[model samples]
Target: MALEGLRQRLTDLPQGRFGVAVSGGSDSMALLHVAAETLAPARLCAVTVDHRLRPEAADEAQMVARFAEGLGVSHDVLSWADGPFARETSGNLSERAREARYRLMADWARERGVVGVLLGHTADDVAETFVMRLGRRAGLKGLAAMAPVTHFHGVPFHRPALDERRAALRGHLSGAGLHWIEDPSNRDPRYDRTRARDALRHLSAAGLDPDDIAAAATHLRAAEIGLQHLLSDWATRHARTHRGANLIDAPALFDLPSDPALRVLGGALRHVTGVAHPPRAADLSRLLAALRSGDTRATLHGCLVTRDRTGIAVLREPAMAEASVPVPLGATWDDRWIVIGPGESGMSVKAVGAAGLSQLGNWREAGLPRAQAMSGPGVWRGETLIAAPELLPDGPFASKFARDDFPAWLASH
Candidate 1:
């Protein structure tokens, strides 16, 4: 394999242990080979996620393990057989599997103290994604395709080979006498990506090749970055967080252009809901239309959005805050609240529902809205309310919002 492309990509990465996600495929195998050669084996770790959707998946994972071990890189295999979609026989399996794969990798990266994981996405993948999203009538963000680096489950994933070609990677592997598994799913027309790949061939014949499309997507990515900067500036001026809710100056937000307004509202919703992606564009457009027509309340993507004379407030849906976790000091509740407890056992972190709120005689004095207060994290020992931090400033257990700063989170995302 040529070392120049991989070396150039590695130059910007921080000095730390890096994890490589290999799926026993050509692209990933090539990445593993190039990265292991470019970086010290001590600084390289390899992981494979077995989705268990195919009978050959386990063997494929073993193939990657053997290859990684041969290269003197530590390897581990993660399984998604027991994940949320283990029994899911319907819906978008591809999307769910991709999510599960990344979720597993993110946990592995954190546990292994790796800075980030490297992926095998290449120019072909980017072009295919652009074509797929174009068919969906996707806007700027979607057409921009896959980013070279992106965060999944809070772990940075680097696609260093985004500018490389799939065939080129395969040829390199072949030249090095390395072998890779070919997934049968790649040929399955039932998948959208397979169809997109077929469409790319026809498009290529018409002189619109993968490289051209990939380059166009790169330009779109630059444009999106510029827009994100504008959104960040606007968010800094108009968005505020109060009791885990994002409050925006409605007049100022609506005064902006439609695209900027949508970006601001979408960012606010994502921040409040802890959802990685923004709400569907159609849903957001409808919500914006309603808000412009004097609607005071709306809901989308597990958030409760309300507009008042002062501004718009995007908050977690009260019912969606039903997630709970044991009071293990550092345990997370609702994927956002970090529990800092009194080191007591037999306690669990739960939403401060109406029952817990009623127990706080001075709840109203806290000045938080009733809905927001109800969704706040509270330590409970069964029916007994142990600590309601949002209501009682001096509670025994104090909790912190993981994404406390809206503007900062907006800028980063």
Candidate 2:
């Protein structure tokens, strides 16, 4: 493969400062070199995230920094610590590290006023991910290839080489007299990705190469986009939001094929709970079956699902709101609600518990489920209920959904 096309694509990007995430790997280092070739060094900023997972990680970051300096490109090394997984010795360390890395990178990009960050995901990644997800029996969305452009943690990310291969990038580096770090974890069988990489060889020998699988994943991505359109249409016709709860027309939802129905229900779960992804396939399937079988209510993913005259209602579980924190007057709380009112120093936001609910005699008249209302954001001053905006229309404070409306939320995620 030639670098001419990649150079053209890089040149076509909008004129502004763009960030590049380099991990001292061959793919990323090649990307950095190509980007510096296409754009001004001042327009290209390199960022390296030292996950501190391995001993050599720090030195690797410094190596990338020095390499960037040689290209006249400024580089910064961000360290990751104090995340939720920082102290945990087990449980999906890869996923936790990935999430933390993106969060740190997003913040860094925003702070530096970078327009977007460029990534180095190649075709091999798409194929390896597909193989890993195949083992989990993933559906279209899970099996689809990563988009060339996507958003994470509200930051834009661009992958200009999803169509390229790892070997080609390494070859490009070798020809340029450049070198890259080879993280030991690449061969660690303890990780799923390493196993996926091993599986790729056997798969290639069986007449299916990475490019072939990547092309198939591209097809699946197209199918997933079409389904998203269908999902948005269904949401407009059958969904409504009340106070933070999503009320979906049960008859319309139940009439949908299992796939679309599951998407609708899953999107609603994420919308209500503000979680990034839906519940696991097994758990979501069981919950869907229970609902169709006339189970009145169920709980999963910090959300409560119940039947009502309107249809199925998905709202934040009261238990999930038990750990309330001091409200930042204009900022969001619990990732769901925003309270606008006087910024009294000691005021906190908590769920309207039974005692607080008793104070709001008109809560029942507000036409919300007891549990949903109980979990509504209530402004308080040391047990002194100041305002329950969802219940009382006239108050010093007002509460509203911090996120988009149900349909838009469903479509975007």
Candidate 3:
């Protein structure tokens, strides 16, 4: 029954090469086995991310590779040891690792032209996530937890096992005479997820089942979707984009229900700043309160929001401006703009600082604030400013800014 369900999900996905993220665990191994049987070997590839945080991570990746090889499926191991993962100094190691894992997998998928990457998140994982979010006093979106399909850095991330149970997947593996590795961290009480899992087991014994929790999450997800549709319409009517900044009708937004209003401002701030996560909820609430009193200026999530005669303008925080960095053809800058090089060998992309703004002969004629214009994408060749595409007329080098899809972005993060 589980295999049939898995086969149906795989068949429903878009017809193209698919990438499976395998960690040599029971759930992931079951997914890989089923995928190998359901799809042609040529249509599937697997990637194992070795975070290198533990000594056995390398061997576990090799084990997954051997299993994939036996199934006639090509596989690759992406090491995080050499990337920013190695140099991370953040206090939240788990969050950092999660971010790094997705980043590496997304890059691998892009290079191989895969349509989507599949994960092995299961029903138990969803329940634990809900409990964790509940403990944190999260909003509806956070409690809703994981989705079956999401996009990260333009690559589709699919979790086909969300409806399946961990034990069921392990049972399938056992029945097939396959063995899987167990990460020690899964039982470590030091981690919040581990504690949540432990608590969920006790709660299940006390009559509150994990399945019931998962069902509640499903309902919350539906409510979240309904709110997103309403917010989309609100944004269309009251939000305007100018020179990479966002101008939202302040009075109109303030008139909205607190939740939707907060979401609108948060979405605008995220879009203007090009950050994956929205600003902290508490900070946003405080900002909204301040805006209600009178004209206000505040900063959050790398963006500056100011209420003025025109409206509320959300701009990239000048202090957080991206430094000049070399950008090859088809490369993205600041996660918001894509640099289109004019077949040039030496080109770099950066925020149009005061110096670059001065080079724009008739800057004021463009009708953008100097700070806002300075935050626009600028292409440079050595010491010469090539173009500030957002401020200037179409020219040689073009920077294409990605449109903000708030609902999709929020879900993925």
Candidate 4:
């Protein structure tokens, strides 16, 4: 059954080399085994991320490596050895660890030119996530649970076992005479996921079975898709990007229902700041309220929202601005703009601040507000500002904002 499901998923993916993340757990082991059988030996690889959070993590990674070797698949173990929980200053150790793990795996995949990385998230994991998000009062997107295929930092992630049960994967492994390691963290109870797992047992007794919960998540995903379509249509009609900033037609955005309006604004802010997640709900609410009240200016999420005679503009906040840094030709700047440098050496790019804005010879001719112009990219040669992309027609250098197609951007993280 697991093999059949995986075969169907792989069939829909592009024809190329693929990789799986295995941690010697039952679900991941089953996925690696099934993938090895489904794809040619040359097309399959495995990666194990040893977060170094526990004493036994290295041994577990080696065990996974040996198993992959037995299957005639190439395997590599990636380590996070720089002080375990070193970046957990915010008190969310698990969240930090998960983010680090994905970053490591995505970097590895990109370096190896793999098409996508497979995960072993199961139906039981999806159900647990739904319950966990509900406990935290997550909004619709969070309660919708995980998608079968999603992208992180442009790396494709595929969860082929999202429709299968954890017990079923373990049973398949047992029948094949294979043994899997049990991670102690799953039963530690200190993590929210562990607690949610315990709660699911009780909820299952009350007729709220994991399958039922997962089915509900699937329905919510459909609704989320509908909402995204609406957002894309609205953005196409009302949102405009210029000079590395986003401008939304105030009246059209204000006329939208609160939910869709918030989503649009949230997405715009994220795009400008190049942040993956949206700002806090309360922060979004406050900004929306101020916008609706005709407030002139507000700031959040490393972005500044300003209202003028034309429309509401979302630009990078001058306070959180990026400092001048030497940029190589064709390098990305401020995570949003790509710097197109002159062939000359020692060129640098930085935000055009008030001082730099005054030196622009055609600031008024560009028709951008002073504040917005200050946020645009400025190319410098030593102490002199040679070109401001927004203010100049065609200079020695230019910066282009990375634009996304509305529909595709709406669907992604």
> Evaluated with lDDT, which candidate comes out highest?
2
What TM-score does model 3 achieve against the real structure?
Answer: 0.91
Give the distance in Å from residue 167's predicted Cα in candidate 2 to where it truly belongs: 2.0
Clashing pairs in 4: none
- Model 1 lDDT per residue over 54-78, tens place: 7778888888899999999999999
Q: What is the Cα-based lDDT of residue 32 in candidate 4?
A: 88
Clashing residue pairs in candidate 3 (N, C-alpha, C atoms within 3 angstroms): none
Tell me each candidate's TM-score: 0.91, 0.83, 0.91, 0.83
User: lDDT per residue, candidate 3, 80-106, as tens digits?
Assistant: 854445545645677667777887888
Clashing pairs in 2: none
CA lDDT of every candidate: 0.83, 0.85, 0.81, 0.81
Which residue pairs clash within candidate 1?
none
Candidate 1 global lDDT: 0.83
TM-score winner between candidates 1 and 2: 1
Overlapping backbone residue pairs in candidate 4 total: 0
